[model samples]
Target: MRETREKVQLQPLDHDLAFLDITTEWDLSSSYHDWRPSIAVPATFVPATIPRVIAICNQKGGAGKTTTALELALALIARGLRVRIVDVDDQEASISVWLRYYMDDRPEELRYNLRDLYFNAKVKLSEASYPTDFENLTFIPSFPDLGEVDEKNPVGADTCLQRRLRQGADDVDVTIIDCGPRLGQLTVSALVAADDVIIPVKASSILDMKGVAALQKVVNVVKDTLNPDLRIAAAVLTDFSRSKMTRRIGGSLARAYPDAVILPARTNVKVGEAQLAQQPLRQFAPRETTTLDYDLGARVLFGLGAAA
Candidate 1:
């Protein structure tokens, strides 16, 4: 069978300039100043020695999980870590689309959908992964047929992703899973497979907060039963506004998950604009405030200096 292709214009980036100016051009004011200092990294902090599996998950649609996953993946790549993105979201497949936009020259033979991993975990993962234009980054594209896996409810369906990664992705420094916006078998598999989960919440809406609460319950259940090592790393606030209600919810979230990190709302419109352009925010608009927010997030997640 032939694969569907969508052509998009690719943007050229000055790699030398981007790498040199990223840290100097970063503006810290865009982050919530009140809470930024609290998570600041110490001079003696050290990143984890082994690879980590992170899942950017939220059961609510439009909660910025995909955006967070992409930005965080870029940040890790910038730090010289090998990262792989697994698109488990059968519906949107935004990450796969982003890769396709960047690499229009991708060969038909290299195009393999993540759905293949369900039937043949190890072999499909090794065969499906394609390299992006960016060094140290690779991803497995998603296909609509991935939705079919949910219906099968095959034995060990919940652990297929984890098993595949363990077998085929041992050399990867970090693997970020972009889960679909529902608590289905796929999402459950991601949660069970992940070492840590980052839940992106939209602070302006109370409904999103409810979604977070429900997801937290599922995280608790998974940790207790399926994966004892699983942890809720943080709850990131996306498209955050400084409205009164936003502040109220932010305060409530901080109080509720006092131990877990609650990242400041990253409000820059450039985030969405960059996504539409099929580019990472840092690569497309390095000096943007939202890019800095993502950098901070990546640092905090990896035990690197938050203020770096």
Candidate 2:
């Protein structure tokens, strides 16, 4: 038995299989800096089974919509799925800044801005795609000029994004769009193209609840008029704290939208830290509670597990 145990311990550990097993105790002895696990693509992995387009949207700013979009994309990539992020938010171009920050620190020629595609009508979607350091992950960087798309083509601006993704990004397993905090042409374009929408709400604010109601009204209107296939997949709470007020607000939100899935609040400082470092949570602090929250949230979003 001792010899058999020694032989088993001598076997090489598979580096590609890095999924969270809630039942197993994590080994903390290993260096956290060296903990990034490669995704092991299964032979049976199918692209058709997953939702093709997901828009992380909220009409209200500071509601963690951008963070949710970024983390969810990372989690999906970690699951051995190919993902492309479309940064449609032109105000801050937060995702674009993150991508630039990442590329500036590294030495790679795979970088292209979204403006190249948005400004030129003849540019193919695949032509604008840029590779990231993460395997199976790519993004179309946004620019401030993206906000002017509405002015440039007022008649068909609402469908510009939809047409672009359909023409160029058909090969990706999933495309996640980070929308600006408003229900304008850009947001409408995203909703029209999305197969599912994930709304991130801050749990402690009553105004956020009102924002959700307003956003839902727009979503319903879009569904009835433009996109019959779009649906509100989930509303996740961000920057949540375990307080009486938060619990009260969360309960109210649950009761208000019974059909919608309300996810647990993801309260962690590492989320901000990762963003500051221009790295995904999985790459910056994989074992942190925030990373785990993103993993659980992704599972729920993709129907991999029960809603948390």
User: Per-residue alpha-carbon lDDT of model 1 for 180-269, expressed as tens digits?
Assistant: 887888888888889888888886778888888888888888888889988767777788665656666656666666545666545787
Error of 2 at 188 (Å): 0.3
Give me the overall lDDT of model 1. Answer: 0.71
Q: Model 2 compared with the native: what TM-score? A: 0.77
Q: Which pairs, if any, clash in model 1?
A: none
- Residue 31 lDDT, candidate 1, scale 0-100: 42
Residue 116 lDDT in candidate 1:
75
Clashes of each: 0, 0
Where does candidate 1 stray beyond 4 Å?
1-49, 101-110, 306-308
In the range 83-111, model 2's lDDT, one tens digit per residue, is: 89988877764787776444343344334
Measured with C-alpha atoms, the lDDT of residue 235 in candidate 2 is 69
Give the worst 10-residue stretch by lDDT in candidate 2.
1-10
TM-score for candidate 1, residues paired by index: 0.81
